[model samples]
Target: MSGAFMGPPWQMDWVDTARAARDSLPRRVRDLIDAVRAELVTVEDPYFRGVDNLPDLPEGCRISPLLSTVPSGLHVCHFDHGRGWIHYTFLRRTADPQIVVEEVFWQ
Candidate 1:
């Protein structure tokens, strides 16, 4: 198992990368991403808070640890906004309480 994640105030790493991806998306897709952000902002830890309360998420969207990457145990918050899925990986730093988003991938 990975080390314990510190609490609250999620942060994103390489935000510009995510932004550029968002900028290239169609407006409808962008709106979906916006909606995900809106939902996420309401909670302190998207990965740990659990998705049971996020009613807006599509069928496959849920918070789960990456199975293939066990031991490292990276947690992901998956959301299917449109035809694609937005997968966010959360990395916890020892010194920070914020969950640093290590990556955001659309697939």
Candidate 2:
């Protein structure tokens, strides 16, 4: 919500720390993320958007809220099929409709 004007409904971007973490990942895992990114970029609110009360998770990823520190507006999307890696992202205010990647880690 800073002075910067947002352009689209569902834009995807990563903070520097998150970008570094994603950069360190191998190609296959990165491919999973790229796939998720494609889906996320089309959803207006990845954290809250849903249909028929089901969670709106990107394909190949399972999501849960990040509850330790910043509880609200923060979430982790983890690989659902036997993978231990997790990707973190958060949405800003309506004026800045962007999903900002917060972190990436392995569990």
Query: Highest lDDT: which candidate?
Result: 2
Q: What lDDT would candidate 1 get against the real structure?
A: 0.56
TM-scores for every candidate against the unseen true structure: 0.54, 0.66
Q: What does the lDDT come to for candidate 2?
A: 0.64
lDDT of 1 by residue, 30-88 (tens): 67666666555446555554335544544545666666556345656566633454445
On TM-score, the candidate that comes out on top is: 2
lDDT of each: 0.56, 0.64
Q: Which lDDT tens digits does candidate 2 get at residues 2-79?
A: 666454446777879878877888887777777777666665456654555344444567666776555565777776
Q: Quickly count the clashes in candidate 2.
A: 0
**Span of ten consecutive residues with least summed lDDT in model 1:** 49-58
